[model samples]
Target: MTKAGIIYVVGTPIGNLGDFPPRAQTVLAGVDLVLAEDTRHSRKLLDHFQLHPKLQTLHEHNERELAPRLISRLQAGESMALISDAGMPLVSDPGYILLHAAREAQVPVRVVPGPSAALAALAASGLPTDRFCFEGFLPPKPGARRDRLQALAAEQRTQIYFESPRRILDTLQDLADCFGLARPASLSRELTKIHEDTLRGSVGEILARLRDDPDSCRGEMVLVLGGAPAPRDGPELAPVLLPLLAALPLSQAVAVAVQITGLPRKQVYAEALRIKED
Candidate 1:
């Protein structure tokens, strides 16, 4: 009996076709059938390499219904490949259903890494790359987005995000409020394309740049926002902190004062001591 087929999760180019890896092309041509997130989008890619595998649509809306059938084909020893509109199959895209099903059925699975928008943006931003995080997209709803931003207000790692072109300005405004206007950031758009641009500055500067051009925004944007400022020297404690401590318990008041005034814990504790005695 022939061995069960393996599922190759391939990553395609985000912008430039030149980003395609030769091994991915070879696998694309060799697969028994190619499952695409969108046939029309996949057509452009297949056309580039003259690959015409048996095509099937496997997007979010229809993935569950079609997963069992696709797995059965794989079980019967037909190797397959999956590709998304851009980038890898499952980074904020569909393919998870098929992947989970494959594991249950004991089929082999593999990856073919390629251009990732999050990585592309981060590498080009010139920000501190040693530590970073990828936040694919915030909640679409206004209230939820704000709540999330507030929760991340004190996060100290460089934050990376992928945003739709239309939401760029609004997201910038939100970031400015949460991260402060002078917070450094980079907005890279039309990446790897001829007219690609990366705007690097404080959040306010990016907002102004987008506002001035009006017509400049036309593609997805990768927003790399700087993280929270590191702890600075403690604020002077006596005048600002003592009065608040008067009504509160020693321990609770000092803790609250540390947060508000950025005062050192020891210094705040001492002020609380002096005030308690008075």
Candidate 2:
């Protein structure tokens, strides 16, 4: 009996077809079948390299239904390759279910790494590459998206995100609001393409650049945000106490602020008195 075949998770170019590695082309050509996120898009990549492997559509909507059948083929000694529309197969795309199934069925699986937009953006952004996080696409809705950003506000490691062209402004504004305008950030768009560019600065600065050069918002984007600044040794007294002072009597505000800040009541009370006297 023939040995069970392998599944190769191949990465294609994020942009610039020249970035397609020779090994990836060979795997796509050699596989018994090639699974693609979009057959039309994948066909262009295949045609570029003169590959004519059997093609099958396997996207988010249909992956669940098709993974089992594909796994069966792998078990039956039919080698296959999975490719996304761009970048690594499963970074922000489909192929996880089928890859999982392949491993569970004891079929050999290999990776053919190529261009990845997230890593590309990060590397070029000059952010700390030692530790980072990949947050693939933020929530489309403003409320939910803001909430998500709020949760990541204190993340110490660099944050990476893939974003859509249309939502660039909204996302930048949201980041400015949650993370504060001074937080450093980098935005790279149309990566590896003709007009590819990276804008690096504080979040507010990048937002202004995007606003002025509306053209920057026209393609796929990867955002790299500097992690929140390390917490100060003591509570931030002023921003914390101002609101309470507005709504409460001086003594009451001081009492509340002291408890909340974990600062000595004497200092808070004195600060409250100064604000009142001013």
Candidate 3:
């Protein structure tokens, strides 16, 4: 029996051809077949690198029907590489069915890491990145999108999202309404392409700029938003007041604690008195 071949889930550059790594180029040149989200788009990339491997469409519509046959080919020792129109495959892109099927069959699989628009935007956004979440594209409908944002209103980690040029304004408006107009965010569009531009500021500020200069809204976009501020109440309130009360007089400490917590002055004063007594 022939040993099964490996499936290379390769990552192509999101935009700039210079970002395409040599390893990806070599893999594409050597693979027996290349499965792409769109052959026409992938062709230009391949042509630029002078690397031509047989191309086949593996988009969302046909991925399910195509998985079994592709698996059979792999099992028979024909190595294949899966790539999206840009960036990594299976990230807001197709190929999940094929990769899952390959795993079940115990076929070897590997990944060629490359550029990611979400990470790029987050890094450029000046937002906290130690903990973050990726929320692909949101629902298109106004009501549904607002509902989704409401659900994530209190998310403490930085959030990343993808939006199209057409819906960016509406989405930003909804985000401002849900996450608050003053929330810090960054909007990156065109990625590494010639027209690449990133707008960083409050959700309201970015929205205002887009409104003023509509040309800024053209091309693919990635939005990185600062997470909701941590709540200071109940148990957490004690730690805040205790330190202030120890360092300053009752009245001054309560005043500082109230400002820090953004809680009711009455509530903070009561807490301060209680801490002083203890």
Give each model's clash number: 0, 0, 0
Which candidate leads the pack in TM-score?
2
The runs of at least 3 residues in candidate 2 whose Cα sits more than 4 Å from the true structure, single-residue gaps closed, are 1-4, 239-278
Number of the top candidate by lDDT? 3
What is candidate 1's CA lDDT for residue 69?
93
In terms of TM-score, which candidate is stronger, 1 or 3? 3
lDDT of 3 by residue, 1-278 (tens): 11239899889999999999988888888889999989999999999999889999998899999999999999999999999888988889999999999999999998889888888888888999999999999999999998898788778799999998899999998877666677788999998999888999988899999999999989999999988777556567888877777789988886566545544445566677777777
Global Cα lDDT for candidate 3: 0.86
Could you tell which candidate, 2 or 3, scores higher by TM-score? 2
- Model 2, span 194-276: residue lDDT tens: 98999999888999998998888898899998876655432366777779989998877866664455343445566776666
Give the TM-score (vs. native) of candidate 3.
0.83
TM-score of each: 0.82, 0.85, 0.83
RMSD to native, candidate 1: 6.1
- Candidate 1 regions exceeding 4 Å error are 1-4, 231-278
Better structure of 1 and 2 per TM-score: 2
Residue 5, candidate 2: Cα error in Å is 0.9
Q: In angstroms, what RMSD does candidate 3 have relative to the true structure?
A: 7.9
